[model samples]
Target: MNSTKIPALSENTNLRYANFIALYFAEGLHMGMLFVGIPAWLAMQGKTPTEIGAFAVACSLPWTFKFVAAPLMDRYAYLPMGRKRPWVIGAQLGLTASFVALAFVPEPLQNLDILNIAAFVASFCGALQDAATDGMAVDVLEDHQQARANGFMGGARMIGSSLALAIGSWILNVHGFTAAILAISAMIGLMTFVPILLREQPEEKILPWTAGNASIQNQTLQVTNWSIILKSLYSLFRLRDSMLVAALMFVSMGSYNYFETLLPLFAVKITGWTNTLYSQAFATADLIGGIAGLLIGGYLIERFGKKRMIGIYFFLIMVITSTLILSKTLWENSTFLYGFIITYRWLNAFAKIGVYAIAMQCCSKKVSASQFTFYMTLGSLGSMAGATLIGPMKENFSWDLTFFLFVVLLAFAWLIMYVINIQKLTTQITNFEEVEPADKMNSLLPNF
Candidate 1:
């Protein structure tokens, strides 16, 4: 290694790193649009609260089942583009097609089923893309680069979502739903170029098949199928103190979804807010919250530790929910109502980021992708349960009661975290040493 060649080599490495970050960011942006833009667009179509809730559930289903297909990326190879790139490209094409189809649905309000089916297709592709992108990020980046990659990935998602909401709102206002869908479709198509331009690292090769190793290879192959996916998913419960952690993730996500699902309805019912006002407030909260969360989450993960930060944030969210409920009682007071809405929304956004970051930190690298996906899936379960319960709660109970119920849920989340000794779990994961290969190999082939 020539001394003079070192700096030039470093520069080349830097360029490659930058390109990977750019590709990750591009993927994030495309995914964010599907997450935020499409939902808001649907809400604008005059969908009822329950219908909106159902749509949210439908959109999240693919994510809940992402583990089923996650192994395909790990086990297979795409000789031309690499293992992950093929999945990414295919997903992008599928997403683009779905969005384009959405553009042609006449009377979107009347064609609710068609809209949902299109959204489901888009969600499915997005889920696959997310899994491939996650695996690629892990495979391509060294340990040192993981943090930076995640930060850029998070930031890009926020930026994409902000742009999507901003653009979708304007298009909905001026050109209507069809035009908005077409414009979004075009954006999705443009994002496909990202995977096309990016290069994938070579796949990691497991050992070749042999009589004694046959059992191990068979097990590895089994792990690649849906049966093992489900088994691994079930293994989530086997982790020490995982129940409470799972509960916390579930309730926090549920509350967040409940608040979001009912937000437009809340605005209309309580404040008599117009569509524009509702859209602006909702979008603003999301953008601000996402940005704040991304920045502060990284900071808290560094400073206060993941466990303490989660506790503090959950407490804050509880306070916000309480205030939101109280604000409903004071709805006639415009000044108080306005202040309450802003503060409540901001806190809600802030707490959400904290909860998510904490959840991410809890997953061990051994099963990082699968565990994280499973946690997300559990959150979806929470959302589904909340959506089903909230409507009847509102009809039978009261809006204030419903909000209070959210507060209770948050409290439940906090209790679960406390009982689970979240700090211990976090410390265990943070200080974890990689399993020894000898031990790993033994475990892989115990009979041998």
Candidate 2:
């Protein structure tokens, strides 16, 4: 790698960061529609909780399995246009098409299969785009910038998801399902243009379309292959710390996924609130409190240290989850419910961003997408497990009991965090920083 290839801490760095944010934001919009807007829509049509859970599974399974294709994303690139950018462009187009198709599906409630199918397809594209963007961020950002970048990335996601939820619900309420889907499609189309404009780090090969670039156009290098990817994965998982991190990632959030799945339905059942009200309240919390958390998360991690900050925030989340037992009464009091959500969402955002920052630290830029996607896959598994369990729990037991279970599961995650010694992992990352990227990647995962 040439020194000149790396962008300095200047306008170029800022531009790349901005592009990363936009990419994540677009992905989040797709998530909001699937998680919040669609669930609410399904409920409005009198779908059962189990049916809604199935749809959530449909949307999430792609993300959980996305790691299977992560290496392909790392190995192949259109060197002419840009490495990751080309993948982003293609995925965004697919996402747009999926939403547009969803828009035309008639009588969405009666066409449940079509809706779920579209959501699953959109999710797959979003996951691919997300992997590409993560690769780009890993390739470009410096070690010092990792935490802050994750913060901004997380912030952008929450803001986009929240805004889409609010707007999608309003559009659904006003102009019906077709309009809502069309609006989502249009928003995605506009956001897709953000990555198309970014300049990928200078490659030896130039675009074939350029008249004078014929000499560089035919040059190709095959850097990523199955042998390399398999070697890397083996190395990543062989470490005890990596194993610990996987456990932490899986159990860290407790029942957050389940809670999220249930919240909209709970609001409607308890308060007779419509989708608009439910979407607005949750979106407002995520947009306001979530942004605040992301803005401060990096600073807080630096100040208090990642371990201490995570412990504190996780404890705060436990306290907040316990409060959900009172949500029935709180739902009856809109003011109190909003206050609870704002405070809880803020703490949740803070803790989750910290986890992501730590995950970013674990990857070597050499195989950033594959390594990071592995961790994200762990997270998705945890979420899927939680969501799958929640439906049965809610059906058999009371909501209060379910809340109690969430608290218990979170405590298990906290226990793992206590045992992991985060300071040691931080030291490992810092040590890797001092080595060459090639050596570091090798040390993390050596060939057998």
Candidate 3:
């Protein structure tokens, strides 16, 4: 295998953090607003649950195929233009344009196709940008820094998501859908400047476009062809521990997605909360709890290994998710309901950060984008499955039963963790080397 050394950490830690945080924040805004704003807007327009699910599915469907774009993100880069920055800028531009066009769509409820299609385009762009960002994160961060960075990245994501949920829902509620879309469009457009300011060189050096290191640029592009990409991906699956991580991917966030999809509707029915109130709950609870989780989870990972943290988070999630069913029983006590929501979201974010910390370890720098995204794509599939099923399950079996079933799924994921020793797997993965295609072919011959 080619020795593609991981890039050294950028000298300016603050600037690097800003770049990752800003991109993740934008990504969170794009997803959170769409999920919160569009669904609430449609529900207010008297759209059925199925239609709301369809809208979310339309937005999320692109993420399922995000793996398809990951290889290109790993390969093909206009070096002078900035290796990953170009993809980030282009994707951001596409999302901004899509949001802008969404503002002009007439009677969005009636013209659902227009809204769905625009959302689809925006999602596609966001997925590509996400792949680039994850790749950049993997490239820059050392193995030891993974937990802390994941904490910050995950926290920033929730912050952005919460901000979008609160602001977008309020705008949709007070002003209207067009205003909400335009507001989001403006936010995305403004964020594009963050990446623009992120030059590859330090203050004294000239930009890469002029006198950048050609050798490094060429090395970045060396693994561009289909044969290499395929072989690398195939090699990824060959890891002894890949199967366990893959299974964890499918079930890790399933319960969170399931509840997140139905929570708005559930709030309306059970707590008699409006869109504005729901968004406020999400913003306050998620922001405060998510930040807390990031801080706590980061520290915990430093003290106890990620495997232990994962086990702890899994137990917490099972407990927390199971308790959400009690929201119905506590409907009259708004304080209790809010408290439950906050705790549930807190534990959920904590658990997910644990997942992110581990997933970062699963990646190989050679195909960081494709490999990391391959795991994320599986996670997204889990989320999509949860989104697709929760509504129908709640409708048929009732909310309490649905929550119970989701907790069971979480428990099952927890069991998988126990069965395979993640710490051992991670160690093995760290030591494993990717065999070159030629080496593999030669090994296939019968020895004399």
Clashing residue pairs, backbone N/CA/C < 3 A, model 1? none
Mark the regions of model 1 whose C-alpha exceeds 4 Å error after superposition: 1-64, 74-86, 101-117, 134-155, 172-179, 189-236, 326-329, 333-335, 364-367, 396-398, 419-448
The model with the greater TM-score, 1 or 3, is 3
TM-score for candidate 3, please give it.
Answer: 0.82
Per-candidate TM-scores read 0.71, 0.81, 0.82
C-alpha lDDT of candidate 1 relative to the true structure? 0.60
Candidate 1 lDDT, 1-448, residue by residue in tens:
3222222111344533444444444444445555666666667666688887777777767776686776555555443344455666787788778878867877877777877777788778778777766655544444334443454455556556666677765786699878877777787677776555444432211111211112221232223445544444344445565566778778877877776677668767777888667656656655665565445544554465545665776787677667767655666554565565566665665555445555555665444456666666788789887788767877898778877777788778777766776566655543332334223332222131
lDDT of 3 by residue, 1-448 (tens): 2211212225566666667777878888888888776787788789998889988989878887778888887788665545566677788888889888878889888888888888888888888878888887776666667776777777888888887887887888899888988898888888887766565433211233443443353354346577866776675566556767777888876667887777778778877888678778878888986577556756677568776887887787677666666656676566777787887787777777777767777776667788889888888778878788875797799778877887788888877766765566555444433445455334322233
Question: How high a TM-score does candidate 2 get?
Answer: 0.81
lDDT of 2 by residue, 267-327 (tens): 7777577767766777888898657855786668766766688789878877877776865
Relative to the unseen true structure, what is the C-alpha lDDT of residue 253 in candidate 3, on a scale of 0 to 100? 65
The lDDT per prediction is 0.60, 0.73, 0.73
Pairs with steric clashes in candidate 3: none
Question: Which regions in candidate 3 have their CA more than 4 angstroms from the true location?
Answer: 1-9, 46-54, 106-111, 173-178, 199-210, 215-222, 259-279, 293-296, 321-333, 387-402, 418-437, 440-448
In terms of TM-score, the best-performing candidate is 3
Pairs with backbone N, CA or C atoms under 3 Å apart (clashes), candidate 2: 235-445
Model 1, residue 233: C-alpha shift (Å): 4.9
**Model 1 deviation from native, Cα RMSD in Å:** 7.2
